[model samples]
Target: MKALMTLALVSTMAAGLAGCVVAPNSGSIYTSRQAQNEQTVRIATVESVREVRIDKGNSGTGALTGAALGGLAGSTVGGGNGSVAAGILGAVAGGLAGDNVEANMKRHAGVEITVRLDSGELRAITQDADELFRPGERVRLLSDGRKTRVTH
Candidate 1:
């Protein structure tokens, strides 16, 4: 019971963290502060759009979750000293399964947008592919000294 709750909580946290990848959110607008801090802005024409899958590297949350759930399940397998051994074994096996599951689930579908700047320089930005962008569309490239984003 306790193990299941822990597993649920950890799973939720892991998913939330994985979903927090810094992609240019659809229709995300820059705040006034962000606009003031931008290093550069440019107008660009989309040259190409390619679908991609972005991997969110494992942070070990899944393995821990699996271990907890597995240990709980294993604890019921046998009696006395044997139960302890089963729980330990279950934890190890569960951890590996959890890690793999987390890795696969953490990947995000994204897009690589290739654009040509007015000055003829070419750049490509990869972001979560939630919104469809077409080639030849005019977009504003927003940068805040570190990351860059393109928007209509």
Candidate 2:
């Protein structure tokens, strides 16, 4: 009776422990800047940029799978006295292995952009200029034989 009770308790605890591992978390942020100046006059250029990402370790699914397999293997080993201890230890080891596998599988994506401008002289003529730039809008430059302008 005592042995059966012990075995039942061990099995229940092992099953419940399978879901103990947590999944990893990750995130990213982006930033950019632009400035305009008067033509034919000396202009100084300055720029700043930064990017950040956060990540956490551990994967829940892999941990549970590993724990179940490890517990089963441990239960198979040792006959009466040692089986329970072996099962508990195996579950813990399997959980950590599963977490490592999950962490390795997790991926974090990032992006970077750089622009360089050359120093040149330009003529400032009075003409109609348009400043129709807005956030979340795509801008492209097109060049024909001689002139380049923003595409619509």
Per-residue lDDT tens digits of candidate 1, residues 1-152?
A: 66675677577557645644433343365555565573567899999999999886887877877787777778779989898899889889988898888788778788899999999999999877867789989988887677787778
Error of 1 at 60 (Å): 0.7
Model 2 root-mean-square deviation: 16.0
Task: Compose the digit string of candidate 2's lDDT tens values, residues 1-97.
Answer: 5467457556654654554443322111111211132113222221211232323344376676667667666776887869888888888888788
Can you give the TM-score per candidate against the true fold? 0.75, 0.38
State, as a TM-score between 0 and 1, how close model 1 is to the true structure. 0.75
Stretches > 4 Å off in candidate 1: 1-39
Residue 144 in model 1: lDDT: 68
CA lDDT scores, all candidates in order: 0.77, 0.44
After superposition, which runs of candidate 2 have C-alpha atoms over 4 Å from their true positions?
1-59, 112-152
